[model samples]
Target: MNIIELFEELKIDKNNILLASPEDIIRIEKQINVEKRINPDIDVNVANNLILALKDYRQELYFIASNRILYTLFSKKNYSRHHFPPLQREYDAEKIQSFINQFLNDDLVLYFDQNLSQNKFDMINDIFDFKNCFPEDALFQLNKKLNIKLDSVLVNLSQNNSENNSAISYVEYRSFYVLLSYFSSIEMDDKIRSLVNIVSERYNANKLSDFYTTCISSMQGYVAFDPGLTSILVRNREAAVSNSIERSSSGSSSGMSGKSIFFIVIAVLKVLFLFAKCSSH
Candidate 1:
C-alpha cells in the first residue's frame, strides 16, 4: 500500500500526509505527537512501521532523513513516559512478545503477497523443540519460509549520503543508544551487542555508560546498578557461573541443604557487599 493508504488502514491521523511529504521535514517533525494523539495506545512496532513508512515515502538523504524521522518518533517527549523497545533478536520470546503486543490491536492487519498459513505449521513444529514460542514467531517464520520481504521502506532511505546533518547525526546516536537499551534486556547475544556497538560507533556514541545503566534498571527484579552507571552485565554472568559451580559442587540434583543454602546466601551477601563497597570507589 502507498504511505497514505497504509496510514488510513492503520487509522493514523491524516496529518501524517503532510509528515510523509518529501518537500520538507517539518511534517515529519510533528509526526510522533500526531501519532500519539491519533492512537495513543498503538503498538511500538506499528508506530515504528509508520515512521519508517513516512521516511521511505520522503526518500531523501537516506540515513540522515531516516535517523531524523526516528528521532522525531522516539524523542524524550514521546518516550519518556512510555518506553518503546528497540529491535533485538535475543530476547525471551514471552518478554519480547509482551512488548510487541503491549499496544497491539486484536484485529491488527498483516500485509503480504503470499499465503502464510502453510509455513506456520512447519515453524510451529521447529520452534516447539526450543520449548518456547512467541506470538510473532509464526508470522516471522512464515515470512522467512515464503521469502516474503519484510522490508521497511525507510531503512532503504537510511543509506549513506556523505552529506551529514549534525542534528540528525545526534538523533541517530540517541536512537542507537535507545536500541541498545531495548536489546540488552534479552539474553545477551554477541550478535546483538556487536550491532549496538556498530551503531554506537557509527553515531560516535561509544561512551554509553548511562545507556547501559538504564538498560540494567529496566531489567526488572535485578538489583543491577553501580553508582558510576556501570552495568551489571557481568553480575548476571557471574550468577550463572556461580549456579553452575554450585551445581557441580553439589553433584546430586536433589538441591542444596538448609545449612548449605544458609552459608551460600551468606557468602553471596558478603560478596555483594564487597562489590558494592568496591564500586563506590
Candidate 2:
C-alpha cells in the first residue's frame, strides 16, 4: 500500500495520528517497503512523509519499550534478587543487554540516516531522556551504542561538507552535552574514557564545564547524578562551591539541618546575583 492507502487501511486520520504499537509499526513498514519495491515510481513526497511519520511513531514506541525494559531490570524489588543468584544474574544480565542492544541498533538505523536533519537530532534527545533513567551499567551500554552512532554521523557530516565553516548550533551543542553527561554518568572503561576526553576537548573548556553543570542541575531529581564525572569537569573552586550549594538546596527538604538551610539561602543569593550580572551585561 502507498502512504495514503496505508493510512486509510489503518483507519487513522493523517493529521491526528496516534501512537502505534510496535507490531502495527512493523507491519506498516513492511507494507511501505513492499509498495516501494513493487512500484519504483512512487511519489517522493508521499514516501518522505510516510517515513517521517514512521520515525515519530517509532520514537514513542521505543521510548515506552526502553522504559519497560529498564523497569524490569532495575526496579527496587529486583535489586536484591539480581544479586543473590550469581549464574542466574549473569544470564539475566546478558538477556537484558541483548534486548537493549537490539532496540538501540534498530533505533540507530531508523533515526540516523545518511541525510541528517533536525529530526534525527530530536530522536537522539528523546533516546537520551529514557536512557538516563536506566541504572549505571545499562546506561553505560546504551551510551556506548549511541556514541558510536553519533560519531559515525559526525564523520559523515564533516566529510560531506568539508569546506563549510559553520559551527554546531546551540541546540546541537546542548544535545551533545546531554549525550556526554549520560556517558560520563557511568563508570567507563579506559578506552571509552579516552574517547570521551577527546570529544570533551573539542568544545570550549569553560563552556563545556558550564554545560555539564547545567545538565546535572536539570536532571537532579530525575536520575542519579554521577559525582565522578562532575568532579572531573568542575575543577575550579568557585564553580565547585556553586554546584554543591545548588545541589544541597535542590535536594529533599525533609528533616533539614541548620547547615542545609544555610546552604540553601546562600544558593538563592548566589542565583540572584548571577541573574543580576547577566541582566547588567
Point to the candidate with the largest TM-score: 2
Off-target runs (Cα >4 Å) in candidate 1 are: 2-59, 64-233, 248-250, 254-281
Candidate 2 per-residue lDDT, tens place, 14-77, comes to: 2223455667657766776676677776655656555555565443323322243332222212
* Candidate 2 ranges beyond 4 A from true positions: 1-9, 12-108, 113-122, 127-172, 185-226, 234-281
lDDT of 2: 0.40
**Candidate 1: tens digits of C-alpha lDDT, residues 120-175:** 22222322332232346544443343222112211321443324322222222222
Candidate 2: Cα lDDT at 194: 35
Top candidate (lDDT): 2
Cα lDDT listed for each candidate: 0.33, 0.40
Indicate the TM-score of model 1.
0.20
